[model samples]
Target chain A: MRVGLVGAGVMGRVHAAGWAAAGAELVAVFSRDEDRARELAGQYGARVVGSYADLLREVDVVDICVPTHLHHDMALEAFSQRRHVVCEKPIALTEAEGREMIAAAERAGVRFFVAMVLRFFPQYRLARELVAQGRIGQVGVIRLKRVSYTPNKPGDNWYLDHARSGGMIVDLMVHDFDFACWLAGDVTRVYARAAGDRYALATLRFANGAMALVEGGWANPPGVFRTAIDVAGTKGVIEWSSDATATIRTFLRQPEGAAGEVGLPLSPLAEDPYTTQIKHAYEAIRTGAEFAVTPEDALRALRVALAAKESARTGRSVTLQGG
Target chain B: MTLRIGIMSAAHVHADGYAELLKQIPDVDFIGFSDEDAQRGQAFAGAHGVRWFRRHEDLLAQQPHGVIVCSENRGHMELVQMAAAAGAHVLCEKPIEVSRERAEAMRDACAARGVKFMTAFPMRFDPSVREVCARVRAGELGQILAVNGINHSENPSGHRAWFADPHLAGGGAVMDHTVHLADLLRWFFQAEVETVYAEVGNPFAQGTLSVDTAGLIQVTLSNGVFASIDCSWSRPAGYPRWGHLQMEIIGERGTLVLDAFAQALTVYAKGGARWPEWVQWGSDPNRAMIEHFLHCIRTGEEPEVTWRDGFEAMRVALAAYESSDQGTVVRLSP
Candidate 1:
């Protein structure tokens, strides 16, 4: 499959690697900053396009790897051109936008896949399967946490702005929100409290009578990243933590005068979740199989995240329609 | 003079452990126990080979120097009142009573009788917890930013059915699990909880149980510190140990992650065990707490964990329920 990637940012680079691992032909790359686009395109032997419109026309599938606020417009344009799209998590900034994106894809008769990559991670996927099989019996409570240093420094990044990135809850915790719903069911209610833009704690009541505590933070020390999930069921409990699963440890001294950028923790998996997600998308597109995360599923996850954000703002619990 | 300590009731699951710990304490005379339930009381007495007083008053009639009230949540006030009126110091199990009015009355009763009243918060005596508290107090971690506490356990209804009974236990996991962390937060930060927001549910026994089996509580302290507690009876019957308490404290300078019950050896037995068990070899916090209770009684000093501590923690737990019910933040009056 021919793929065109937009936005030569951190996620764009990651998605490029994913597409490469999936053996997709990275035909083009586009970014507002031409140098970054050229640098990324040069790595994958892909050409740099001057505009998003030019990039969309060049490939059968357009991967939207831009900032969250840009996802709706870019995906809509891609679907208008009858090109399949792979968008990053959250689908869109608002539920309305997500719904519109889904509708546009249906209207164009093309596939729309959202990278809710947690569903591709082996641990989360296995946990979901276990819960579905009743290995842990009826679901009861789930606790999930993802904490790391702020994506970029506070003043220098769009992620710090709630308007652009939806802050920590919408951008980071949304993964766990989707996972919780995937593991249990639809969330009926959301209650959340956030401290600044750094940390947030949300409690979701699922339609199946299960409760989940979803915590996300940008408050960890530099170079530290942690993620954990604990699910309690009627018959047993299943738990996993990033701290407990590390098979490699490195302690190297920093070079003099080097920029102290935060490092992402690598899992050292034979095939990372991003690659798995991209491969799944490729296979589904090829065979007309259902995408692991449908547009509607992405919208549901967004609704829960938006509700949590609203709850945090109002200091009240927000209830979803039809649970 | 040896400190004489009597057990008020054995209706609580901790009663057996407390009884054994009391017998092991030095210079303390353990004066048997009493229970309102005749069968349970007799069974406990027979198992421990101690005198069984059929009535709480009968136990108080022993005129012990101090009494440990290990009754069910609803029975705490009655037993404490009896012990206080009998001029004996009281070390009562957590959630002093089912309601604020009763808890306050119990406190007044003890205060009026000039007998010391201590809340049984064993985590305060836990060595690891103490070291962390000391470090935080010493400004080792700098100014506190946030805290995350987890107290998870198997549903107590498996062994003590009253724990799931709303009337007997006051509430479910929220009532049973929230106090230790509530008290500990106050002790660590020396701040009062100004607001509480919680989402509670009975996922474990949704159709059968009338009380909540799990709660996720968020609180804002007076010092501007925010914290969350995942308090639940979500563990299954086959879980290795009864439960665990863990905390993550975020401070300005650094962060501290504490697993209070992580000091355990993994044991895989050859019997019909389906899961590996965690055998804890750490210092017994209950023993330390009981020793502190005896020391306070002997020295005629006020207990470290006071009636106010228990009252405040219960207040937080009750506010959690109110917040869950109303779907809004419940603010406490300072």
Candidate 2:
């Protein structure tokens, strides 16, 4: 399948590599700067387009890699050309823009997916599978803390501006919010707090007693990368620590002890998730498979991120807005 | 029914705590102690009133029912394996085996042997921590969203020479202390660590520790709770050594911050040269731990602390180690 790329920035470069790894032929590339597009196009052996309209008219599937606010317009442009759409996370800056993109995709009879990469992460996907399998009994709660030192790279500073990136909630945490919904179901309310554009703490209440605590921060002291999950229930508990990707510790209630999980719980896919996601998008066009993580799921995640911001601002719980 | 116990080393400070616990129990007998540093072992055995053997094999040969592998951070696994192979249950000290691969192997070995293999994480014995666990599980705190852990000690861990070697202590304050906070967080909220971004370094151990004597770990748990822990050996010198530990648990209904090792009195005295007043506090966590381990062994019923309890603490140590290496949030293994 042939593909066209927009926005030759960090994510653009990543997706280009994924497209190549996934065996998607790059038909064309587009960026705000002609020279940038030409440079990427030359490297990838693909043609360069100066206008979004031209790129959409050329490629079968348009992958939107632009900044958050431009996503809806660009995806809408692709839909206008009858091209399927695969967009980066936080599908749009607002729910209305997300709605527009969803409507456009559905109206054009094209496939739409939001790049919620956690769906492909081994531990995350495995957690969903295990919870669904009732390995830990009933789903109880989820607590996520995602933080990193502020990125000092050139041009990446746009994330610090709330007008563009939606700060930590959208740029970093909406992924967790989406995962919470997927793992626990539709969120009902949110309680949250944020300090400037750097840090936020949000709590999501699902319709079930299962709940979630999500924290995202832009600034951190650099040293190590650490993430983990602890699932508890009526029968057993499962705890996975990132340091050992294959090991999951579990404890059954009556046994008086917990044991490390057996068998491989990590993903078998060797390539980056973007590679798999984009390939799935391409496959959907040819085979009509359901999109991996749909636009509505992305919109639902955005609702949580926005609600997190609102709850943090007012120091109260905000309801999750569904599409 | 009594549990026979042996010691593998004397390098860790908690060795003394273990010896004292054994002395407190009528059913627990100190089988023997093995240390590479013969003099140190002799001195330790003399102080604890136990026999000292020159080689680890001698201690394992005792065929004790259980062993406390309290050697240097690097020696945890070898000793635990020896004890487990000798048909004995094992209690390896926290900062369990430096790396996850080794820890998993050791855990597997114990599993295969059908012997109880535990990492020594005595703090789960704290009354307040247990209180938090019961209350949270019962929905007393409602839905837990955020948690903060503060661990401060006079003369951060780098005060010891061996602690400075990443080879010996596994990174620094983050590796040493995260286990306590992580394990507690796991038990308190019944959550797993989902992702962790950590900043680890030494601030004051200019001459001593290889790992940072001070560090911070901010983690996201599997249950979607935001958590932060500030850990350091930053307390003033010539003060109490037990350290100060506190936790703030946030839930849907209310927030609870408990000072698990809170000392009742604080003495502040003015300095002669326009300096801030010197303050002092005390704690009894060690004694609490001694009581719990003994009680668990005596009852033969489940104890307050369990094997999974130790793994939670060890997992945090691995998380901080990984986060410091990758410079991003690391997802824990499945």
Candidate 3:
């Protein structure tokens, strides 16, 4: 598969590495800055395309790695050219844009995949599998936190702009929103509050009667990334944290006053999540296998994030339409 | 001169720790104790080689220089009133009286009698926390922008039954765990909390427990510093220790990370104990708090953790419960 990458930023560099490990032909690279594109292209021994139009025509797959607000336009353009598309989350800044992009992909008969990389993470995958197998029965409550340092750039940092990047909730926390939905199903209501641009907390009640408290923050020191999740079920509970030596832990509901959580070790995956996601997407495109996250799945995650932002803005609980 | 201090009740989980601190301090007399649960109180007093007063008032009537009120939540006010009436400086265990009115009354009674009223916010006395606060005050971290903290603990119901009873404890983890960090943050910013929003769950016991055992609380301070606290009793039984306090403070110039109980030696032995014990090697904050309480009384000075500080911290905690109950952000008055 020939892949042309867009927006040679941090994520662009990450995806370029992913594509190389995925064994895809990195046909070309495009960035608004010619120097960035040239740098990435040189590193990967790929050609640098001068324009988005030229990059679209150069490869079979278009990977959009630009700022979130540009996702709709780039994905739309990719679909218009009949190229298979992989867009990073959140699919777009608005639901309307998300719908239009999905519709465009459907009309063009091209595969549209969103890089919700959490689904590719080994621990999260195992957690979902365990829940599916009812290792922990009758899910009741979940708590997820993804905290990191603020992304500070010298100039024109799109992430600091809420309109462009949707701030922390849509940009950073959308991962947890997607993961929570995947674990507990569609959200029925959301109550949230934000502390400036850095911190946000949201409580989501799922249609299945499970509740999830999702917390995200961008106030820590630079390069500090911490993620933790706790899922409580009828028969037991499952927990995992990035800071722990153990990968995952589970506690069965024993008789009263018994020990909780038998620590379980995870078999480390060979490939990083980025590489795995990239490889999975490429394989799905070639073999017609199911992708880890569909455009609609990404859209549902976006809706929950938007609902959280709305709740934070209005100081009231926001109800969602069932997907 | 030795400052005589009496323990009011042995009901609080920290009662034994306080007694130990009193014993360790050379200048403090570890006087007798009293509790409504006479057998339990007598057992504790006997274990510590102190007299067991049949009536709680009898212990107060000893006219000790200071009294450590370690009764259950609802019993704090009466103990404080009795200790204050006996002209002893009162060192009340936190969430001061569980209600703002009761807490204020305790403070007023102490003030009218010219007695020092100290809230036992031992976290404020933690050496690591004190160092961080000192740096912040010195402008070493610049203007504090945000604070995040966690006070995680084992299910207190495993430690004491009263912890699961809302009537006796006022609230659950939100009440028991919130005040320590709340007091610390207030001290750090020298400001009151202006607004509070909280999310709580009973994930540990799946609501089979009477009170909530988990909480995530956000507070916006009058000093423009935003803070969040995870006051949860979700620690596992086999966890190394009962709990630890952790905080991350982000400032304009620098950031500070504080683990209040991080200086510990973990003992891991096969077939030795149910859990690997994390023996704390750090300075004992409880001892510092007791010494400070005695020093305030000896010098006729107000306590660093004054009754008003306790009231404000308790008010913020109570507001957190209300916010969780109402499912909205609650604003506090100045």
Candidate 4:
């Protein structure tokens, strides 16, 4: 399959490698920054296109790796061209925009895939499998945490802007929000609180009478990232933490005149989740098998995240319709 | 004179550990224990080689200097009143009683008689917790930002059936586990909880029990530090230990993570063990707490963990239930 990549940012590079690992031909790269586009395209032996229109005409699939605010327009343009679209998460800035993209894909009879990659992470996959198999019986309470330093430095980054990135709750915690629904069911209501954009906690009540506590933070020191999940059910509980599962540690000596540094802990696996997620999308599209995460799942996750954001703003609980 | 100590009841599971500690304390005269359940009381008395009074009054008649109230949640007030009237200082089990009114009455009963009332919050005496508390108070972490706490245990219904009885225990995991973290947060920040929001569930014992077995509680303190407590009876029957208490405190300058019960020797038995057992070799907080109580009695000083601490913590737990029931944040009255 010929694939076109958009936005040569961090996610763009990650998706480029993912498509390569999934055995897809990367035909073109498009970004407003010509240098970044050419650099990423050169790594994959692909050409850099001047505009989105040219990139769309050259490939059957368009992979969008831009900021969340740009996802709606780019994916809509791809769907209009009858190309399958892969977009980074938070599907769009708002639920209405997300729905419009989903409706556009339906009208064009093309596939739309959102990268909710937590489902492809081995630990979360196994946890969901266990729950689906009734190994833990009926789901009860789920506690999920993701904490890290800010995605980019303080200034000159769109990620630090709530308008562009939707802050920490929508941009980061939406993964857990999606996973919670996948493991349990739909969220009935969300009550959330935040300490600026650095830290936030959300409580969700599920339709099955289950509950989830989802916490997200961009407050850790640099080079620090941690995630944890604990699911309790009638029969048992499943718990996993990134800190506890580390298989490697390095304490390399710094240069003579350099300041001390913090090293990220490594938990290496055979295949990374990004590649696994992209490969799954590729195979499902090829074999007519269902994608693990559908557009509606992404939309539902965005809706819950938006509700949590609203709840945090107003200091009140937000209830979803038909939850 | 050696401090005289009696146990009011053996209904709580912690009573076993407390009774063992009492026997080990060198300066205390371990009088005996009372229990309303004749069979359970006799079994405990026989196992420990101590006397069992069938009635609380019979035990109080011994005129002990202090008593540990370890009755069911609802029975705490009556036991505390009886012990206080007997002119004995009281170390009451947590959630002092079920409601705010009853807890206040218990405290008043003890205060009116000039006897001390100490809450059973052994985590206050835990060495690791003490170190973290000291460092936090010393401003080593700068201004505290947030805290995440977990206090998990196997369902107590397996050993003490009343824990699942709503009327007897007041609530389930929210009542049982939330108070420790609540008390600890209040102690750490030196602030009262301003609001509480909790999502409680009964998935663990849905068919067999009527009470909730899991709860995720969010608390905002008066100091503007928000905390999350994943307090539940979530450990399975095959889990290695009773449970654990862990806290991650985030601060502006630094962060501290404390695994209060991580000091243990993992033993993987060869005889078809279902799970590897964690045999703790660390200092016993129970013993330290009892020693502290005895010291307070001897010195005529206030207990570090006072009735107010327990009362405030119980208020948070009660608010957790209210928040869960009403599906909103429950603001605590200042």
Candidate 5:
């Protein structure tokens, strides 16, 4: 399968390596910066497409890795060319734009997948499976933390702009928002607060009566990336943290038949999470199988994230119209 | 000169620990204790080998120089009034009163009687917190941008019944836990909270935990520094310790992160009962706080944590509850 990559930046490099691991051909590369496009294309031995439109016509699937604000237009154009599209989260800045892109993908009858990479990570996937299997029994509360250093790029970094990136809640915390929904079902309401552009905290109430607390920050010193998740249920609790010696720990209420405070072993999957996500997308498109992270799923996560930003701005809880 | 101190009530969870610390103060006499519950008072008094006064007035008859008011939330005002009327300085346990009005009245009554009134905010006495506050004030971190704090403890209802009563404790985690960090942040920023927005939940024990056991309070200070405090009672029964106090202060130039009780030895109990416990080996903040209280009384100077500080911090904490109730930001008088 041939693939075309857009935006030869950090995410683009990650997708390039993913495509290589997935055994797909990197047929073309496109970036506004000709030098960046040429550099990435030279490493992959692919053509450096002059424009987004040219890249669209060159490959069976187009991976959109551009800035957040450009995602809508690029995905729509990709669907117009009847090409399968893998767009990075979030799908778009606004729900309306995201809806339009989804409609376009449906009209073109082409596969559309959102790169919600957390779903591909072994820990998060295992967490979702545990919840589904009722291993913990009726999850009551979930706490997720994703904090890292603020991104400092030399040029105009669109991430720093609230208008383009939707601030930290949308840009940084959409991962947890998506994961929360995947684990706890639909979010009914969200109340959030932010400290400048550095940190954002939110509480999500699910339709199933479960609650989730999300803490995402960019205020920490550079090179610090910390992620932790704690889910407490009726009979047990599951916890994971990047800083811990154990990858995951589970505590059961009744320990007679259970190993209390059992630590889950690490995933033996040698490939990176990004590679897993790309490989799944390739398999889904080739065999006409459903993508693990659907476009509608991405749209729902975006809706919650946008609502969190609104709640932070107005200091009011935002209630979603529908689950 | 040696200072004499009496315990007004033995109902507070920290009362016994305070009494133990009081016994260790070399120049201070741990006079005696009184409680509304006679049996509880006698039990505590017997445990410490001090007299258990049947009435608060009888305890005051001893003419102690100061008293630690470790009563229930509503009980604080009456105890402070009695201690002040008896010509004794009062070191009141947190949340001076359920409401700001009562707290102010207590403050005024103490002032009218010429007695020192101190609120117990031991985090201020924690050496690590003190160092951070000192460095932040010295411009080591530049203009302060934001502050984040967490005061997490085991479900207090498991330990104390009054803590779960809204009337007796004001509120749950928001009331019982928010004050200490609020006092500390007010001290660090040297400002009062201008606006508060909060959310509270009882995810662990929805039908059982009577009041909110998990809460998040976000505030904007008069100094333009935004802060968030997580006053959650989410610690499990068999956790390492009761809880912890952690703060991260960010500034224009740099940042300072602090864990008040991080200096500890982790002990795994035999047979894995109370599997892991953090035995604190750090400098005792409670001792330092008691010492400061007595020092202020001896010098006839104001205490480090005053009644007004307690009143102001309570205002912020109460504002958090109001915000959570109304589902909107609650503004406070600057």
Candidate 6:
């Protein structure tokens, strides 16, 4: 598969590295930074395109790692060129924008995806596997939390400004919000609250009478970071982490007697989300297999994050706008 | 050798169950219970066929080797102080007290008096919940992704206004229902709550527990599993005295969902018009807890419920209240 990468940012470099290692053809890399773009492109054995339009000329997959504000317009251009678009987080700031991009991609008959990287995380993949196997009888509830130091670099970091980044709510939380809906069911209603525009809390009631709570923040003092999640059900509980140093644990309550612990640790892979996400994308492009993170899934997540922001601003719970 | 135990404060609802269980244990002596209210003292004593006294001091005068402080939440600190002063070991119920400061006092008093102090957290003894913890530690569930706990009951405030008042209950359903779930989650995963996001309501709390009938608790555990819970005392009555609890611990190889107390086979009388077993089907949770307490006391080992366990549970509950106050998430110090 020939890949053209846009936006010579950290994320773009990540994708370039992924394509190089996977034997996928990296046809070109595009950026406003001609020197940096060519330098990074050469590392992947690909040429640098001076303009975004030049890269779209012949690539099969044009990954858009540009700023959120630019996603809507750039994605349309790539879609019209008949190239699959892999956009970065926030997908476009709002579900409406995501829809526009999705509609364009559909009209062009090209695949589209939002990089919700958890779907590619090995521990998360294993969670879906356990659910598939009925290891925990019918998941009844899910609770997720993602926390890290609040970025002080307001203008440069991009996550500090609420307008540009949507703060933690959209940029950080949309990932899991989409995940909860993907696993549980359609989220019907949401009650949320925010503090200092940094930390956010939202409770979602799924159509299945199940509930999910999401806590997203970069407001804590500097540290490595902490991500924790738990799902409760009829049989037992499944708990896991994003940190590679930790292993997953299932608290099973059946099959012969009393409650007990079952340690399940996945084999560590050097290739994390960056490599795996693209692998899934290429896999999807070839076989039409789902990229794990679909446009609809990404849109649902964006809706949840946007709703939380709206709810926080209004001090009222918001309803999930169904598409 | 028989372990002579003194019962302090018969005001707590679960006190009678502990009295009955102690009598059944051949190794335990069913010593008299003390109640500030003599009516409660006699009622508890007569109902369980145990002895009683009007004052906790008089009860401690018996010089029993151990004491069970089953009193009002406010009285926990005082009763624990008395028991420790008398050089008697102590076992108290959840919350330890209404505040962390008071709970710490009780712990410090117990330690200074060189007495065994345990808080009765019976959910730890349930076979189903423990199984989940076992499998998690054994690495069968793989690297965890998330954890959740559900605890619901008829409102805690309706029956007792003190359960709703901040000075008495400390918080609403957030305090009443949170400890058990927090302790259970912490024990099962061996994780601490790092941050909390909560939405508290006062719906069913009518007279006592307040209108905050339901609450959603969002938290992150130290082990890096994002966790949350829907805890409340807002279920419809006649449905069941107890609501329910379910948990999902998501992992690498598989997920573990634990539905503790999912089923209870109730016997129906022929041509029954009402639940005839209201008299017969009393609480078994209390019985299970007391039995485990005796098991630990006799074996000189830690019971499933320890005082430190109660402290951590209280911390989680307090954090939830803090989250509730601001209507946002609050992170706890490591």
Tell me which residue pairs clash in candidate 5.
none
RMSD of candidates 1 onward, in order:
2.1, 20.8, 7.6, 2.3, 6.9, 12.6
Q: Arrange candidates by DockQ, highest first: which order? A: 4, 1, 5, 3, 6, 2
Please list the C-alpha lDDT of all candidates, in the order they appear.
Answer: 0.88, 0.69, 0.83, 0.89, 0.83, 0.71
**Candidate 2 TM-score over all chains jointly:** 0.51
Q: For residues B254-287, could you state the per-residue lDDT of candidate 5 as single tens digits?
A: 4577888889998987976466778889999989
Which 10 residues in a row give candidate 6 chain A its minimum summed lDDT?
A: A257-266
Candidate 1 segments whose C-alpha is farther than 4 A from its true place: A153-156, A251-265, B272-274
lDDT of 2 by residue, A19-79 (tens): 8877788989999767778888888899998788888878888888877878887888888
Model 6 chain B: lowest-lDDT 10 consecutive positions: B273-282
Stretches of model 4 off by over 4 angstroms after superposition = A153-155, A253-266, B270-274
lDDT of each residue in B1-334, candidate 1, tens digit only: 6887899988888899998988888898898998878899889998888888888888788899999998889989888888989999999998888899999999899989999999999999999999999999999877887898899898888888898999999999999999999999999999999999888888788787899999889898999888888889988887888888999887766468999999999888878343689989999999999999988988888889999999999999999999988977899997
- Please give, for residues A1-323, the per-residue lDDT of candidate 3 as tens digits: 89999988877888999999888999899998789899999999999988899998889999999889999999998899899999888899999999999999999999999999889888899899999998877676677878776776545788889889998899888999999999989998787767666677777877876767787877655545677887766555677877674455555555632321111112356777888889999999989898878988899999999999998888677878764
Query: Which candidate model has the greater TM-score, 3 or 5?
Result: 5
Clashing pairs in 3: none
lDDT tens digits by residue: candidate 6, B183-262: 88788777787877666655443344333556788676787666667786545443333466777565544345576775
For model 2, give the TM-score of chain B: 0.86
In terms of lDDT, the best-performing candidate is: 4
Q: TM-score-based ranking, best first?
A: 4, 1, 5, 3, 6, 2
Listed for each candidate, the true contacts retained, as a fraction, are 0.58, 0.00, 0.15, 0.53, 0.21, 0.05
lDDT of prediction 5: 0.83
Q: What is the C-alpha local distance difference test score of candidate 6?
A: 0.71
i-RMS, each model, one decimal: 1.6, 18.3, 3.9, 1.4, 3.0, 11.0
Q: How many Å off is the CA of A114 in candidate 3? A: 0.6
**Model 3 CAPRI quality:** incorrect
